[model samples]
Target chain A: MKIGVLVSEGPYTHQASDSAYNFVKAAIEKGHEIYRVFFYHDGVNNATRLTEPPRDDRNIVNRWSELSKQHNLDLVVCIAAAQRRGIMDANEAKRQGKDADNLAEGFRISGLGQLVEAGIQCDRLVTFGD
Target chain B: MFTSSENIDPDDEGGVIKKFMFVNRKAPYGTIYALEGLEVVLISAAFEQDVSLAFVDDGVYELKKGQDTKALGQKNFSPTYRALEGYDIEKLYVERESMEFRGLTEDDLLVDVQIVSAAEMADLMVEQDVVISF
Candidate 1:
């Protein structure tokens, strides 16, 4: 099955990010094709490269980055939502005249159209949020 | 950038046209869910899939007419419901119990929606391949 994931909340503050990560990892372990993982609303915070967690705690951002690197996952952050929440790639940062780019590795900024395409192309589109 | 298989016809895979239902359970203005839900619906329509909008609980209030969010300093996006038909997304189901509980009637809504019983709405949800709750 081709699975598309939609994460609507940020990490640490909510359990949504953890649940989505576990579900995506399990789905991949089961040999399912991951079409894309779309970050929307507060979920855009997951793609920031500036996160720093305690050594004892699980790093949700790093986990997603690892998954992307290992599986070649399409980690997409919604351009509109990311901009409002201040999550942008280098190109967007330059275009908008920002000081720096904080988009984490393995994640790219895109439009809501990508989410729509995921729903249409993937066999299953699962959403995790509050 | 779009993927290589972005244009693949859904039918070509297994002749399956997935039924996607956007379940609205939150009220507007207080949270971003309702407005974002509408945005997703409009975007999903471009893919030419079987999409439906279901309103239950406080979500039914999102369609109430005479909404003015000026005092709240928010944009009242209720009028966007009128544009759903333009996207060919006509299936709008509102829970009868929820509407009555909120002291609202079909006439109170700004757009056309079928008032369905809880059981009917459950059936509609069961028929969907994907249910995205907001």
Candidate 2:
């Protein structure tokens, strides 16, 4: 089955990102195709390359970026939500006249239409959030 | 910068049309979920799919009449609910128990809606291809 995932919470403060990562990994292992992983609300924080964790703790942002690389996943951060929370890609940063861009590798900024498209295109759309 | 076969047009002729339901369980204010959830509903209107919105729990407050956010310094978005009809998204369901619990009735709402019992709401949900809760 083709599946789409929506993650709507920030990392560290919430277990949503972790749970979503595990679910996506298991789904891929089980031979399911992941259409896309959309980050909305605080979930867009997962795409920030500036995130840093304690040496012993799991780095949620990197975990997502790595998995996205390994699977060639479409990791999309909602442009509206990301702007509200200060998550920006290089182009968006330049357009908004910001000092720097922090969008992590393997993730791209896009419109909410991507989320709706995921719902329409995928066989199932699963959400993880507060 | 990346493209693939998955990026097909949502409005493609003879394309799959699924029943997409947006479940709102939070109040309109005090949190961003209600506002952000409504954003998704508005965007999904462009997809030309069978879409519906469900109001339950504190979400029932979202449709209440006379909501003024001036004092809270927030955008009073209640009026946008009425404009949903223009987007062809007219299927709005409000749970009867939730409305009564909040001391609200159909007359208290700013827009027209179908009051559904919990069982009926469950049936509606089960019939959908995708249900997204906010």
Measured by TM-score, the strongest candidate is 2
Worst 10 residues of 2 chain B by lDDT: B1-10
| Candidate 1 local lDDT, B64-104, one digit each (tens) | 99999989998878888998898899999999999999999
- Strongest candidate by DockQ: 2
Clashing pairs in 2: none
lDDT (tens digit, per residue) of candidate 2 on A31-96: 999999999989999999999899999999999999999999999998888988999999989988
Q: List the residue pairs that clash in candidate 1.
A: none
Compose the digit string of candidate 1's lDDT tens values, residues A50-74.
Answer: 9999999999999999999999999
Q: What is the C-alpha lDDT of each candidate?
A: 0.88, 0.91
Number of clashing pairs per prediction, in order: 0, 0
